[model samples]
Target: MEALLGIDLGTTGVKAAIFAAVDGRPLASAFVDYPLFHPRPGWAEQNPADWWQATLKAIRSCLEQGARVGVQPSAVRGIGLSGQMHGIVLLDEAAQVIRPCIIWADQRSEPQCRWMTGQVGAARLIELVSNPALPGFSAPKILWVREHEPELFARVRTVLLPKDYIRYRLTGRMAMEISDAAGTCLLNVAEGNWSSAVLEAIGLDPALLPPVVPADAVAGTITEEVAALTGLLAGTPVAGGGADNACGAVGNGVVRPGLALVSIGTSGVVLAHAEAPHVDRSGPTPRIHTFNHAVPRAWYLMGVTQGAGLSLRWVRDYLGLPERALERWTDLDAYELLTREAEGAPPGCAGLLFLPYLQGERTPHLDAYARGGWIGLTAAHDRRHLIRAVLEGVAFSLKDCFTIITAQGLQLEQVRATGGGAKSPLWRQIIADILGVELAVTNASEGPAFGAALLAGVAAGLYPSVEAACEATVRVVENTAPRPELVTLYARFYEQYRALYPALRTVFHALAGLS
Candidate 1:
């Protein structure tokens, strides 16, 4: 039996999973964690060396597991790569990493964003790149390095996205797939190529960027060195895989129009697939993002919430000491215990609300200075209310994305839920009620890794197309329907939640200034 391998290079770790090439059933998986460096405030960096080491360990471990099930390294037909988007990886002439990667969550490029807006104008930037010049994008991060660390920038011979760098390490080739390239703000998203105008405007050389390939196409073959290092066959085809969100969409079968994906990881994302390129040019900055989809000739509109699972993690780390202690003796997870406690709280948390801007706000409000807190708390409320309010607050922020997508006239037919938070029945129900839509959970709980495996299957000729591959392998296993009463309650509470951010904007900025 043939098998496929998928590697997901996430923010905090690397996950490698193997799946049957015939069907999408997961065979074996392994994960290896790595550290994220924060040298200064609002900055996030990761060493590419760490990612490579983790990827190697994960692949070896996963292959060992696959071996127990009668699947060998030689049986692996293809490999796919996916990772966090919009990160800049600089490489020197000798293929050495020049600096630590400035990842997606880093916020040090606001000045670069402003400069891009001034150089290209906001509306034209959208027209050129199909999105605003956000601090998280590759172009702005490149500019930040150019302005702040010119000596290092001058020695940069190539720029790559996170996964593309991994691809190079595996294949000994330097090329980027279109789905990840679209997030760079250097790609003309509509035309599906690097934007010369944007590059020239930013005083960047086009040669620094790698050639763009289709997500399902074979990017290159695994080199003999990587094969020996990771226990894979030399010359195994590597698919030009996607960004994490795009791969997540594919994994959950959100390929066609009217289908959406709601993923709640460290960050939350609501993405709607579009058959045509849809640019939101209504304001100075587009409320969300429009990028090339993993599927050829398609696009997706994405809205990001900087903190989703992150908000729940804050509760787990700071307030759930009892749950953590219980976890040592019990099989239950700490997050599960916390969500169960939240079940005791009534809907709306007794008028208490939380702003899940622990990492600042994204989506409709693009403010990096926004802060997180519980508002309308009363002496009568307890810890249950605080926990429940955090969950509700995250759902409300996601609803903000859902609202904007629907406002653009895309009638969503089905919304697939995927991520850590979606595993909680209470949290899933809360999101359904908050968004007034049923959430379907698919069997591909492996998320982007599963999607990457399917893409690998396509590259290996196991499937005719991306949609065909998903149709054969992906299926909805369960649904979470919204409670009518809770939906009505959330509608009223959502309006109040909507008001909190605007009212607190000035104070949030003031606090940021003081900091």
Candidate 2:
């Protein structure tokens, strides 16, 4: 039996999983965690060499798992690569990594986003590219490099996303997939190619970007060096994978209409698969993006929140976590311990509300200077109340995405929740309560890696199409439906949660000492 392999180079880690193509289920998986570098405030980067190291380490671990269980490495017919989006990787004439990649969460390029909005005009930019400007996107980062790091910018010959750089290491290939390219804001989303006009406006050359390919197209084979380290055969085909968000949708079988996906990571996002590009020029529900999906010729509409798990992390590490109590009460499980405490609090967090926009916000507001804080905090509040507010605040943020999508006439019947945050039952329930929709949990929780394996199945001819691969392989463990009473309570609380930002908008930037 032929097995498929998938590699996902995510924000914090690299993971690889193997699945049986005949049944479309994962057989074994391996992972390696890495560190994120924040050399300066609002800047995030990862070394390309570190990613390749993790990728190979993960693949070797997966191979060892297979061997321990008596599966042969040569039985792996194809591999696929998936990764985080909107990162910038530069290569010179020799194809060496130019510098550490500027990741998706870096906010250093805000000035560039604002300048582009002024130069091109928001209306014309949206008309051309189908979304508003985002600081972490590829175009602004490219322009920033030119302005601040002109020496490095001039040395660029080709550019790739985070995972594409890994593909380059694997097969001596230099290419970008459409879905990942779309996140760069350099792609003509509707036409499905790099936009020369936008490149010119930004003073970036089209040649700086790599050639774009379909998400499932063959990228390259494992070179002999990689094969030797990985204990795998040479010339193993590697399929062009996808951006993490698009691949997460693939992992959950969100290929058809009326289905949407909600994810909570460092950032929050709501993505809906569309048959074509859908643009809404004017509404409270503004879209930051419509991008090519991992599925060939398909597009996805997305609403992104600047902060998601970041809120939880802030609450856990910097705020009111009762550390000693959690070690004893919840087996050192921070999320469960927090949720158990939250479950004790009444809905609305006892009138304590949080905006969860420590990094400003996306979705309806689009205010980069938006601030987050606990409202109604008093002597009566405690750890449990504060923790509950954190969950509710993040839920309210995700609901902003749902509101935007539904306002555009796409009624989401269901949402499959993924990411590290999705593992918490209390967190998923909070989201369902806020959105009033059923949340499904996928059997394989490794979203991007599993989806990359599904792409491998397609490339190997074991599955005829992406939909077919999903039907053959993917499985949902169960559904998370909102309780009627909780939903009712959250509905009222959500209304107030929506207003916190507007009321405190100016004070956020003021507190930060920004004009």
Candidate 3:
């Protein structure tokens, strides 16, 4: 009858899951979508209140479903939070939201990132923390507010990451977990707390940040006000969980060193779970990120591709609108419909390469202004060719990241794959062939939400340890291997795909009209 609940505040939605303390199998789960706001061309923001409301709705739905499945709402003992990383949430002295939570994908703080790198010295910064500057990181966003909204900056009291903000609402506690703080670019990763040096250079008071804690530790209990609003017990324990990605890695059982995961969500990422810190100081500008593992004192290395599924979504919603009229003729899904016709697309899209940078790019490019395109489109080809090229281009970009991960000394024997895009057999096959790694896909797609519930089980004394939770719960459903012929074909095409970015790098910037 015992159960633990996990709530994940994701970029696209919020998910709540209830898991049995006995075996860690998820008993029931629910998710609800919320709106995203883009005030300017490059700015992406969300209301903190909306995230809290969406989380509560998702949790209530889960509690209802759990009761239907024989686990009553009161059986939910301990709860943990998993949320998107690098978001800046500020509160005044009275603990009121001072601004919209600057989300992880927003690119409005490029100048702040450059300034921090210059002031802190990038090498010293990386040595102090495990990662380098990204425009979306929390510290850079904080600096952005100071430089742009100075009046509001003067009133700031406490700064919180996305899940930290949620936890603040739930338990009236200002605290953060190490894995979430790692993405903030303000944490001393080795010390597992805020870096005073970075704080001083950035001109922010160290006291403004929350006290850091380990992911498994309990931060506080739910307040009476939250209990009345959420319909849960007033004294329910709230654990500090990691960011969505780290918790997702935990959810998928990538707790031990040597295991890697391929997540093709709105953005794409290839992460390897490492026991010790993994840093490559020598080459490649070192954009690969490292964060403390959600599993007690562990670490992980990850490579990212920013324009994975979004590119396909863009193409389908924009360029392929005519293809839907084509959709009425067949039962195939848009991807299947496109893939069938596009596979007929010759290798390299018959010289039609796409950059896949619809929303800028990350990993190899790291260029926010990096625009996307079809290099050689013609009247001879139609929509399917363009659509397939986007998919292949995304796969090729992911391979570029995987190549870096391999360079950093992580062996790639197998990869555990998850996410919405992972459902497509063709995309999965394409990634397997392009990366040249055997890929295993799991059945449960709840990802970090499921992983958060597992952590809850650990906290509630349901499992001896986090390892035992994954060992008992996570299972692989299918293993995909690269076709020999397609692998050989992609090897040649990948070389060309890698070079295309640099060749057009100047042109991408020029077309920006930035000058």
Best by TM-score: 1
- Candidate 1 residue 231 Cα shift, in angstroms, is 0.6
Task: Report the number of backbone clashes for model 3.
Answer: 1
Per-candidate clash tally? 0, 1, 1
- The CA lDDT at 57 in model 1 is 97
After superposition, which runs of candidate 2 have C-alpha atoms over 4 Å from their true positions?
Answer: 320-332
Count clashing residue pairs in model 2: 1
**True lDDT of residue 294, candidate 3:** 87
Compared with the true structure, what per-residue lDDT tens digits does model 3 show for residues 1-515? 88888888988788898887766677888888888788976678999999999988887788788878898767887888899888989999999999999888787788888899999998888888877788768898999999999999999999999888998888988998889998898988776778899888878899888898878767878899988887788888877887888887888888886788888877888888887778755464576787888888788888777778778877766766554556574666665565666666665677677788876776876677778888778888767678778878888888877887778887655688887778888788888888888999865567788777777667766777889988888888899998888899899888888788888888877876562
Ranking by lDDT: 1, 2, 3
TM-score for every candidate vs. truth? 0.98, 0.95, 0.94
Worst lDDT run of 10 residues, candidate 2, spans 280-289
Candidate 1 accuracy as lDDT: 0.92
lDDT of each: 0.92, 0.82, 0.81
Q: Candidate 2 overall Cα lDDT vs. reference?
A: 0.82
Segments of candidate 1 deviating more than 4 angstroms: 323-329
Predicted candidate 2 versus true structure: per-residue lDDT over 250-328, tens digit per residue: 9888887878888887788888988888886556324547888888878888888877888887777677557566567
